[model samples]
Target: MTLTSQLTVGVAAFDRYLAICHPHKYALVITRSTSNIMCILPWILPTYVILGPMLGWRNWYPGIPCSFDIIFPKSLRATAYIIVYIVSIITAILYLPVLKTAWRYYQRMNKYQQNQTRDHMQTTNKMKKAILGAKVTGIVTIAFSIFWLPYMTLSSWIMVSPTAKSKLESDLANWLVFFGASNSIVNPIIYAWKRPDVNQQFKKVFCGSKPVSHVEHIKT
Candidate 1:
């Protein structure tokens, strides 16, 4: 859930970025009128893809409320598992380009920081901040992949390999779940830890005055 929630927020951040940075284009790309709809569709679509049929299968039976097991009938379980795998794969695939673009920008911007003449300082500073946000988005995306991939892989392998019943499986699942939970915490953590602009903007919103420096906020 932490992973999913983090992902949701990250997507929201991208949408918000477009709204702030490219307000008119947002409507052309996805539309301001349907922003909430667009935001939620990603989060909820997975359930319908993965569990909606599982729920229907339960209706045909008696006590089975939820599961991705063989007892649910071969065809149904197979379909559900495939749905899960496909969704997980698609999620990973979808994020790859985002990570790549973010990484390149991050590297370029980090390198650009070595020089800042007064004449081009403002322009470079703005570009650097833009790149930093992309870098943060990439990190958040990678963290999400790291935390969730194991769970998804295990799920995919559960039927083929029965080795998942070991105590180590429980431990791995426990830790993964914890990491997933960290996703929600990360939005704030990234803001305070890695993103000075976001933190300063937040401060201005709540503290009633502008902060002096990005480095100062980061120093804490």
Candidate 2:
């Protein structure tokens, strides 16, 4: 779940990169086929490469029930952390051009809009949309780290330590797992709310109202 949720943020970051850094090529590069593959790989790789092998471990401690939700053994936990770190690093790298472009747009847009022409108005609006999308991506990244990092740290600690901790500590770890799982639900809401163009669609879907603007929906 953590990997899949983070990949959505990377998807958005990549789209923002195309839009901001290479606007002319976005439509050509992000075609129907490519987009489908981008969406599919995340769900497939994590479940198969990470979760699949973990489930197939042969050296389970005797007498432990063979259930899916067990506390991961040391090797499995380390593997999971490695996958998480790789995903996080790649996502962070994708954000670089996005943030830099947004900063550049902001600097240019601030010069003078008092005597704006139609072309200037259009450019400014596009820049604003880009900036908003970048901000939403930043928020998603921060939220993912907040919810998942501590849970992973504590889980690794539990695996390493020889003795069992107190009931309170165990309960805290369980709650952290729930918190990390909630990122999947929270992420869509973040994308919808933060982007002005998307917020209109959000309202229309849940509120049963007319769409507010003809603004193109920001890709997530």
Candidate 3:
């Protein structure tokens, strides 16, 4: 799940990067097959590299039950470390470019506005979409990092701790897990909120009628 979340958000960030930094090439670079493959890697790595070995070695370890919960202590510790660091690194790599791209685009747009550049309306519209994509990417990146970092940190600590976790610690861990899980639920809401067209279509489907005219369309 950690890998999947990071991968998905990373792709979203890359999409923003292409839209901002290489607008003309964005459509060509992010084709349907490319996106599908990016989506598939998270599932593939977890299944083959993580779970596959666990399944194969399930019988080798006798005392620890052959279940997902019954991981070897060392393996759990390593997994904990992997999740924490890998996610953080991948997120940084993904978002840093996005931040740079957004900043550069913003500066260009400001300069254009001040200079009264040609094709003002068209340029502004494109800038708005690029900026909007950057904002959405930023939201997803922040949400995932904030939600998962604490949980992963606490989980790693727990995995390495010699003593058992107290009731408070256990409760806190459980709550953090829920907080991490909530990001999945929150992401779709964020996307729909950012894109008015999506929200309007969603409303129409449920209402079985056209959306109200007063609903403000997102400029992007």
* Candidate topping lDDT: 2
Question: Clashing residue pairs in candidate 2, if any?
Answer: none
- How do all models score by TM-score? 0.53, 0.76, 0.73
Error of 3 at 137 (Å): 1.8
Question: Per-residue lDDT tens digits of candidate 1, residues 49-102?
Answer: 456555653443666544334334545545644654454455455455555655
Candidate with best TM-score? 2
Predictions ranked by TM-score, top down? 2, 3, 1
Clashes of each: 1, 0, 0
Q: Show model 2 residue runs off by greater than 4 Å.
A: 49-76, 159-170, 214-220
lDDT of 2 at 194: 70
Task: Please state the error at residue 19 of candidate 3 in Å.
Answer: 1.9
Q: lDDT of each model, Cα atoms only? A: 0.57, 0.74, 0.72
The predicted structure with the larger TM-score, 1 or 3, is 3
lDDT of 2: 0.74
Clashes of 2: 0
Which is the better candidate, 1 or 3, if ranked by lDDT?
3
Residue 174 miss distance in model 1 (angstroms): 5.0
C-alpha lDDT (0 to 100) for residue 58 of candidate 2: 49
